[model samples]
Target chain A: LKALNGDRRRWDIAKLIYMNNISPNDCIKRWKGEDVDEDHESEIEEEEEDFFQKRNGTASNEKDAHEGDLETFKPYFETLDRLMQKWKKTDLLKDRFIGKPAFSNEDDA
Target chain B: MAPLVFQGSENFRLRLILATLAGKPIRIENIRSNALDPGLKDYHVSFLRLLEAVTNGSKMEISYTGTTVIYTPGIIIGGSHSHKCPNSKPVGYFVEPLLYLAPFSKKKFSIVFKGITASHNDAGIEAIKWGMMPIMEKFGVRECALHTLKRGSPPNGGGEVHLIVDTLLAQPITIHELERPKIMAIKGVSYSTRVSPSMVNRTIDGARKVLRNIGCEVDITADVWRGENSGNSPGWGITLVSQGQRGWCTFSEVIGDAGEVPEEIGMKAAYSLLEEISNSAVLGRPQLPLAIVFMVIGKEDIGRLRISRAQIDERFIQLLRDIKTVFGIEAFLKDVDDPDSDDFIVTIKGVGFTNTSKKIA
Candidate 1:
């Protein structure tokens, strides 16, 4: 458990921990015995976004081990939501209005 | 009849999953066709063998180059079966996908998955036990159990997991839950194999230190394996699963590395669990794919689900797109009414695909 010069070793070599998900980005500040506040938590959120950044240029989305990335997805998801609402409500309603009515206008009937 | 054709090795598992569930044949081309070691990997081969064992007459044809595959799915005739999982991937890799097929099997699904229990790339057994189970229960799965019979580490893998699902759902219920429930309890598993038992205590202490601030009750169990049950390697790890009142559950775990101390593993898992709890949706990130499947296959009525915006990563998007292609079902995504929360409500209409192979009661 001792590091060089009789100092206590930190997290194995500490390098592997940094390389993995235990980085401060995943909220390790709390584990480090550091004071954590809302501001620090918000900062961690931004770092996490960077951690899950977009890699859309490479490989098919369905490929093994290549789940979708983090950045860019929020915007893409927003656009999709808007388009779905437009098509499901506006276009479908318009298409139905254009087609023959289930019952002709009551007065005409 | 022409079979569904797909390109590349993407969604390899999903394609197989959909094909089996839909009783349709699928042909996949150009799997890792451009890579240096272009072709199906060892895990892929082992997974395919496991699939065949779990079902009846699932035929698979691989080209001499291993870049193309044609799989004719068979009915799930699940029963007692055992397979040796490749060390390249953990048991969770094979078992996660298999659970999707279990509820539709002819008999109660019973399988023994022997391999490295924990790995960097896959969910550990504890996640499936505490986290995945509750999610399945929300969709009307009656009784299922995941037992970690042995602990194994990578390279010299020799772990075993016995999974049993005694009940089947005629059809998964339509779940339209939107509220982000409150977490009431956090249960955890800290384990060691062929290592000093002190490692487990150290891990629990480190985890408890971080979790002490939370208002909920935190209980972490320490598991130790003896003799042959310890598997072939020495390692330690921790998996923390959180439970909310309304069937919302999630898990985070960390496996000890070659030089990593037990305390670090505990702290890592605790921190990750905090990250997961921050996205307090009805399902955890790992549970999203499973929810998608049953939501699409359940009753024809629309099922609405709420998920944090953080969970809207590429894999989730691609899975939705794939469902649109294969099942011809689209999910209606929209912002939740609560402006304070960054959650999206996904509304999907299930296809009402019931298990035809199941025997009549």
Candidate 2:
């Protein structure tokens, strides 16, 4: 996708997945600015931020006594393969690498 | 050939390596041009010096201010050589790029790199040796070995690594593996240098606790180094390798921050390994770029690999652009229609590149 305009700028990807009931392909298209439906586009809830931090293991000040070291496990899956399959099905993964040219060259070359 | 012109200091190593391999001169301008320092970093300069040492007839010129670099490519004349890698970067930093050039050199490549051996910034020494080596072997370049003589931590760093890559390939075998392999076992090494031996065990305990629930046979060795081989700094780290029956390997490493507890490092590493497995990558993230580069310049045939969408990040796209610019080839990408897989099969026809430095006698 080409460069997106100002109005359709950066949407918090993790929030998009957890909050909305959207197809993976459509979510990706929306992320790339191919879809601009305004109905489902809601401001991210502040309380849900803590919930996301718990699931994704972001910087959470407080931790569970026993499971603090471990990442949030999907309680429904009994086997590791089953859990992996669940992850693959949900397709919650994001391309996490930085795409911007490191050390930008904005000046005349 | 016209000199390939690029901007910025990012991907400094790959650009130089590709230029050397293709025997095309390159001119890089506006390197960190608007920054406060506004020039190439010391490690970049050191890498350039390393290129000069291993290759013959290479010419490099830097503008007086050091923002622009003009490099004329040369033939790789491999031999027994040693380089003092600056402590700013780990030996893994130099070793990864060097692997691409080793088999293509005139002679059996042997190089001694001394510097910080283990760090969080890049893949550590063990990851390259245990994790990436098998991937290289699949492409049919054998007889590559790494012997870590000393383990060095960062800051006040003093560590040493010896690398030997002898066997050469007529061409890398065309590879295609689309199915994500099932991991059968997990093995790792938890090593400490100049630190209390008990710390290693604690780390192992933490990792084992998490791995226990995964229902796999896990084996981890605790290596405690004493005196000289431990290097000048006190540090510890762990390297974990998980593999399936299909030769698919994934690696995770964590270096202990100074005065940090070993248990945290172990937990961190275990979590990282789990993340890699669940990421839907057929090949681990770090090795994908290396494989792509090799395939792009390999035998004149289409090579295909199945990888997940999450695997295609920004650096990967940039690499594709660079590859197109340098080799005039594009990767044919098609979405996988499999019900079970969220992946794309990448197809590319090789440029039939051969090692000009290694003339057939």
Candidate 3:
């Protein structure tokens, strides 16, 4: 499905739904659920150190910092997946006012 | 590297300021494409030129029809330079962006600006001086000041302003816990240029009538500029700012339009300021952009703020998206559970960015 329309001016319905469903707490919770072993723990610590050190012009390595950002953003993608499933079950685009206005008698007068 | 992309021309100033601060390239498409003129206007071009003046080696690419813009920003080298702001917009339009960029520049910054100082559409210069400068001071910008050398009105602007900022990187400051401080005093400035000096007195009288009923201690000063200090156009306006003990301030202003009486303008401005003061939120609408910028660049702790519901509009949602794109920070908005409250607490964990480009002493 197209995320943006042909003119690329407006976001498609799917994109809008995807954006509206994001939950930050849900994202953080999903990140905490990931399994962590000793090796991964050490890697996380190193990445954390590099994150601060890079800003101070001390760290030369860029690959680990890139991976750290991706790791931090992973849970947000999971939350998006959950939202898409929930949005599909609800008919958001359905027209609720299907017939004439309720005050039609006044208009006819 | 892939550049960040955005749609439409809404909030272009915020986008450009964020792009420069984050050291990222950006591309904006469909700039006024659906409008009658269908391209960048003079003010937009003027803003781009201002951006070019403050930075070194910046590259900008505009489409043939000016519908698309690609900006590659350079390091901020803030020094003394002057620019003629497009007369269509107020000088505040240009000054607001400088407030975001000045502190982190490579050198102590000073700029002399020439344009309209006050208008109905934007915040007046007095509001920026009294209301905004104090807020910036809370964020650890020590040597920032805005001086209005002359008063200018719209449509044939010749006002002059001098802005100065010390060359220093902003230290991360926490504004997480906000308490509704006691209103110390309601202060204001009623200014008139190229008009009868009596207009200033009338404006003060009218504003005092409304503010007196509020039961707050109101002290409003009248400024009547004459001779060379007055600009090419004739105008009168009032700026009302409420100062709080906790370093919070809210401002409201009204500029005189054609056939509008001075007292009417004064009453309108006073009522607007009263409405802002009545709100329970800690910050005002004008201060939201500055708060968001600080949140994105501050130290890596959750920065929290309580803002009124009216501040949470489409522009704010766009700001959230821009923050995420440029700085990789996610802003979370949650409603205050009190049924009678009309405020929301916004929280963001900063990206822990430091100004690494500043030359070491």
Candidate 4:
């Protein structure tokens, strides 16, 4: 716990706490010393920068980094949504276009 | 068969594996086109070589700058072979696709792979052993084995693993329903090579601290390798698998770093396993690609699966497009309506592909 508290500035440690069931309030109380508001906020700010840089490879600021990450994945989400819409439309049209033959050649023969 | 063309180097493994299975040629262009050091890397070349080793009559053409490659796939003639993987990537990167292709090979496939066994990026060998093999069995392919002969770490790798699989011509599988199985126990392997033997114990102790409250029996074994079994590098890592009923297992792992403590690795791995278990998905993250492959090529009927959105990435979307283009199998994904639900139900009907030619049957 001491080690984690000492290295609480690291982004991975923050991630670890976030992933586990520990609440942010408890984490702040245990890891960050009381009455050190500036230090605690700075540490979180630095961790956010590190997280964004690691996530999308470019991070000028936290907001820009987050937007960039979203931009990187926006095309994929759009493509998936478009594909799903097309498939749904195709399913609606399948019965009319792909129904059984009205007159079988064997019956005609 | 007409050649399938695509841009970019993403989904390279999936494209090649599907091409081999479909008996079609593929032309990939603009590989890393915008990157500073664009084109195929040494690791990509090594993967291509491994593919060539498993197939017969395969032909490849590469541009001088390595920006373009045209691959004509050949018959999958599976037999004993070996390849040295590049140090840049872990063996898991290559092993995952091999798991998809091995069962359909013409002969009983046995391959010895040498490279990094565990790393931060790719799925570790232990994950595949516990998580993927059982899923493959559900698809009716049996007698698959992955054995670690030497433990290796990243940067300078010398690990060795032996893989064996029995081929099947055509096997139809039906999995209409997936029930969330109750986790019976949690098992793990904490290993170190050329490192302090106490590292294993530290990892196990740290993992147990987090895992004991999960209401399941937990057992983690430790192994310290030396001499021939230990690779050149000095490193340690932990692989944790949560075993559930109905052949369901979730895997998580963490590789040690220069300044990281064993306890951190163990705790991180345990938390990752817990996250996976809590995520309401039928297929584990690593098993998502394999399940999609089976759904595309299995018997012609509706196949349904509910997977977490975390498993759906750009590579998975590209794979769906490729399957649609090559095999004419359409896949649909619909998000569940629950506000707290993170599941996407995917449905697809297979193309009923069957292999008619067998070298020995």
Candidate 5:
């Protein structure tokens, strides 16, 4: 705690409070000898635990990794779908004039 | 056998036909030093007259020596079957090493050549006319004339005279053979939605899929722009192809670092892409004419104004000219200028494997 106070960085401070489920101000007040409820820390920990569980259901580490993969690919697929949808209209017109594609060989210079 | 008549000296005509079949006009690499001046004029007149008759469009050529004047018509649009001379003497030789057509077939074309020996009775002013014998037989105009000019004195003397008259009896050449996939006979259409560089590849992919769905064989390379620096990155370009035909359509959005280029500027780039393809075929190399749209959502007030001006610039006119010069392609542009449009459409018509051709080494 003393090391954290000495560092005094915004993101690091937020990380310490949020990860530990404690209010930095309350910690500071207690450090300065102000009276604080012992139950308040326990409540904060419960809130943090509830927040994490709600956000990421109870899944094994491997399952979590697979879910991460799905989450990552979702945006890519969305972009591709959007692109395809955008092209659909013009593609219809292209079909009207260009007609069916004919067989062509791979040899090209 | 129908007799064919050649109206002029034969040697000159043979050279001309040989040159044309070789895909180039005959070059007078080096005239034999001892060759007489009289012979030159005779060759020139005969060559010019035959060309005039064949082309049906007239041309006039004056030799440096005041003694020679040659006239010719322009190039004929189709092949013909006609003869210059039928039968005369054996002063000159006509060699048909591989006459593909049988002698008696309707396709049979006969050539009669005559050579003139100054003193020999067997060879008087040789002339040969190549023609379709059956056609000549129908008209009964078989015999040809070989004019041998007598030798004269200096100021006019010391030059041997040779005149060549060639006639070809050819039928109109039909476009019978399939266009042998000359210079990228491939064809397809690509539709694009955005002006962003990534959309360029997207458009190509869209095009390829459409082609594939329609049963076209497609060969696609890996996405050109790959990895973290992919989207919104500057200077992205790709080569997309359905077949041998290649296209390079790229657009870059310069963000914070360079700031947003005015919308008109983006439009200018898009318009230039069209111009390049349209003019490419005329300048050389076949290009698939395309309809392209520059889609942009305006960020700043200035960007919109800039884009509006670019949409109707002289560059567009030049682009149209290039398209016309190729297989008559016209590109229609669509944009926000006319709203209620789902997407901007650049409609392309008659864009296929058309090209400006030149012989390559």
Candidate 6:
């Protein structure tokens, strides 16, 4: 598998899964006994950090805010991740969206 | 057991120096210390070996941990700064998203061991450059090669693309697209929920408190409003201070100056300040734009959409007029309809000639 994919863009799905943005507790609730998609998996990665920050009540930087701020910042991150996955899948599909950059184009992807 | 590796310590330093001197290219792969999963063990080593083999014949520095790498072109040079001074160019280079740098020439990239500090985290590469830019200018060297050993990790958590896109555009867009301000004013709702006069007073108080916490004068009246349906009428409407198209404009002056403010340690004062304000806004709508400016001074239920800078300027002028008229101030309304001077800051006094200070708070 390592040889199959070139060294250029090797993606560790598990690392992505562990580094997911969703929280484990949330995962326990929403994803319990269910197959998690790549997007939800990424969200869970950030959930642990969020849980700790909640327990501790303080972290040095805003980045330590567990996940992106629940209100404003998180949406952008989630949206970006969604777009990236959409892009990856789109790249795999038969017809490609033209006139847009490789990484952009979130509509109908 | 292997010697306790104090990263950037003498032993590690010696190996890098000898390797660079021996004409070997260096590679530092993903730097992680947390307990790793057995599943990722093979791929991580494979990532490092590829870098090791690629630079085997060249003189370069490679710093490798479990999953992070930093490969520089040329010998593992140190002692000197990488910053470029006024009279000189830059010597060191760093790029984000850990993309592989493919050189077009045979020029061997040099390496300098700037001890690792979680350079593997997202946004690490880009944020590091903000600190490095000023330092690099001091070194008086220009242009160096950079190749990441890891696969993906952007300096801004992959925000580089958006950053670049923003740079090309002459003007910033509404907060709607840029930062996603919660909608305070619905298109037809008589009053915006996000920021109403009631909400405005409270949120501004909140934002003021936030500013005070970070230390800054929370002066400056924030006028929020919706434009008139037809002819010019007083548009005193409440809007979320951090929402809609106008919110970004109110803060742009502040956000733009963030690079100028200094701090004892870490990034510039302005970056942190904007980050705080943005983060706070995300938590809830706190700031409101002062109404009574955009001629709809008395209208109700305007939709919240993105506004341009020009539109903001035009509206501010209208606001100033109403402020003068309603308060009976000394400044003459500089043609409230003046296509030329909106916010009619008397070109002469640079103040609203009819300045009437009020205690809205």
By descending TM-score, how would the candidates be arranged? 2, 1, 3, 4, 6, 5
lDDT of 5 by residue, B28-123 (tens): 322232446433443344435444443434445444542333433233422233323212222221211111111111222233322222111111
Candidate 4 local lDDT, A1-109, one digit each (tens)? 1233223433322232332233333343333332233345466855764564476632234434332221121111112233233333222222212123332331211
* lDDT (tens digit, per residue) of candidate 3 on B1-361: 6789977786788889899988899999998899899988898899999999999878999999998999999988889999888888888888877888888888878999999998765657887788777777777786888889988987787899998988477445766844445566678999988989889889889788765534346789999988888899999899888877667787887788768788877777776665555443676666777878887798888888877655553345556767777887777766565555555677878877677558762
**What are the Cα lDDT values of the candidates?**
0.72, 0.73, 0.70, 0.70, 0.26, 0.24
Candidate 5 lDDT by residue in tens digits, A3-107: 332323233211222222333333333333332333355767557644654666434333434322210110111122333444333322222223234423321
Better by lDDT, candidate 6 or 2: 2
Please state the interface RMSD for every predicted structure, separated by commas: 23.3, 21.7, 20.3, 23.0, 30.7, 24.5
Q: Tell me the TM-score of each prediction against the true structure.
A: 0.77, 0.79, 0.76, 0.75, 0.18, 0.21
Worst 10 residues of 3 chain A by lDDT: A70-79
Residue B161's lDDT in candidate 3: 91
In model 5, where do residues sit more than 4 Å from their true spots? A1-109, B1-12, B29-33, B36-44, B58-62, B66-74, B77-361
Error of 3 at A2 (Å): 39
lDDT by residue for model 6 (B88-171), tens: 101111222111121111222333212121121112222223222211222211233232221111111111111110011111
Q: Sorted on lDDT, highest at the top, how do the candidates line up?
A: 2, 1, 4, 3, 5, 6
Q: How well does chain B match by TM-score in each candidate?
A: 0.97, 0.97, 0.96, 0.94, 0.21, 0.23
Which residue window of length 10 is worst by lDDT in model 6 chain B? B162-171
Error of 2 at B322 (Å): 1.0
The collision pairs in model 3 are none
Q: Is candidate 2 or candidate 6 better by DockQ?
A: 2
lDDT of 4 by residue, B36-150 (tens): 9999989889989999999999998899999999999998887999889999888888887898888777787899999998887676878788878888887877789899999
Model 2: DockQ vs. true structure:
0.03
What is the TM-score of model 3 when looking only at chain B? 0.96
